[model samples]
Target: MLANPATALELDHVSRHFDGRAVLSDISLSIPAGKITCLLGQSGCGKSTLLRIISGVDRPDPGGRVLVGGTEVAGPGRFVEPEDRRIGFMFQDYALFPHLSVADNLAFGLRHLSRPERRERVAKVVERIGLGHLLDRYPHSLSGGEQQRVALARALAPRPSILLMDEPFSNLDQGLRERVRRETVDILRETGTTAIMVTHDPQEALAVGDMIVLMRAGRIEQVGTPFEIYDRPCSAYAAEFMGPCNRLTGLWSQGRIETPIGAFRADLDMPDGALALACIRPQALSIGPDGQGISARVMAKTFTGESEQIDIMVHPLAQTLRMHSHVRIPMGIGDKVSLQLNGAQVHVFPEEPGTDDPLDQS
Candidate 1:
């Protein structure tokens, strides 16, 4: 039994191994009731494998336990089948049977109920998704969006306590994806369902999840709200993965890192003279000629919608840096410029092995 009723889903010391390879390492997480949580990570980060463990599709290595609504579903000795767990799952491909009608597919999971109860449950879900008119249609005859709705309705018809979605909108084009994401979020909120989605896209995770669990190399890197993860990243890997940033390495001294661009205060708690790095997001750098900042020369500029990407070569650093600036400074190739850093937008982390960037020692 759960010690806290407010938690809808909980995983304790979950680990998965395949053929002597560890895919997940002692993962533990507690999901509060009625909130959407996103499991975010890059490809091969073991997000999908973790999702499988949560749904009881794959058993975890010996020292693991999964709990739903204070009831133990899987653990070192206990085991629960996927269907018995009463968890709804939405696949990457939507997984709607082409031969079945929309109504039939929605009713499939409701088979455990009486015939009348199944029909009523299916009808309710169809209405909830606003797909009443498409009930008689087959998956092959429906558009991608329609098929996606049908799949969602089918999963929801069972009214599982928790919903698990794996890359649910990856198949749709960019425009359709945004719309569907909004719709899904709205419905999940209206129903007050606890949901966990596995996604590789950072933006999607921020937009869809109330809280995000970032993973890397089969380990939990950090867990926080979107603003907390993006603005206050806990590691260099977390900072870079959230968005593009210019990395600079320097000796940690008096709360500042000396760089070719000039020493800037990074506010990190590290031993003096230890190697550390600064993560400056593109948006943090502003370009101006007579500005009090780092001296640089514009190498190239690529206009991208509201802002232009400025490729600049720092005169003192001799390293080309990229910045995105909204200020329309008309400067051609080889034009001297000054780069300014917005301290509020920058992030700093201690030197860690296997990070995407290494400080230039030379």
Candidate 2:
């Protein structure tokens, strides 16, 4: 299939309200052409709602605008229907027609074209997606992954400018989900399709997205490449949302924050003697020889195939600290070990008011 010229998407203060409550608030984002941009956040963070507004499935509130390829699709006194916007939408369920065969389903959107043109379009998409063998099969006869590919082919058959996927791989099992998700990303890249995918999984966003837009409670929390969002989160909420972190409450003093483990350099702006929170990822902690760092006793160990998660009870803190080790540690439960922190991975942020313990939030 010939690659469609990718179109960039722009949202200008796009806000959506329902029954006097705001679902999306002041969302202004510029999605680059021919790249996968993942809309990442927890459930009800307005990721899907924002996608709907951009696709013309729903409308934004007054004064908000949505532009596609430098043309306003939705704004004050101007609105384009979803079909007229030339956008392809792949739903969470794949949404393949139950009665139609694979080939017919792929050609469903090409009804306006001549019969030969529709057949040629479907053939091109099927060949590109390697779905030729399943052309005669029905939706009920296909596996989850096959159904997903069919839905993708159907969406791409019309050669839309941009593709919008909402939790595309949520239906597949863990193993199949990983493989299918990778294949889907490869196809998108191969076709040079500009895509905006909504997913609640941080790992999915980190793995497949060229750019990640982290959303929170109807607002964009952070936007950057996967590394930036993971390494240099803008806030405590952003830090924890991307991955699990061992949060510690401490007092900022003399350009450093003193915690239960030790004093870490405070890179954030905080007044002297003010409360701050330190976010340390499990991968940042390592096991070293006794007396080299803070003393801790191994409370539990979980083997996760790629790495072993060790829970250690620190003397200064009431809760246990979790650490991930790729190499098998010659340590057992109740064994005393020294825990060393990688200073580069320790992030400090101003503590949220009314929260005594940073770990207690959420």
> For model 2, what is the C-alpha lDDT against the true structure?
0.90
TM-score, each model?
0.95, 0.95
Candidate 2 lDDT tens digits, 141-239:
999999999999998889988899999999999999999999999999999998999998889999999999998879999999999999999988888
**Cα RMSD, model 1:** 3.0
Error of 1 at 102 (Å): 0.3
Off by over 4 Å in 2: 1-7, 354-362
Off by over 4 Å in 1: 356-362
Against the unseen true structure, what C-alpha lDDT does each candidate score? 0.86, 0.90
Error (Å) of candidate 2 at residue 329 is 1.3
Clash tally, candidates in order: 0, 0
Q: Which residue pairs clash in candidate 1?
A: none
Worst 10 residues of 1 by lDDT: 353-362
Give the C-alpha miss distance for residue 262 in model 1, angstroms: 3.1
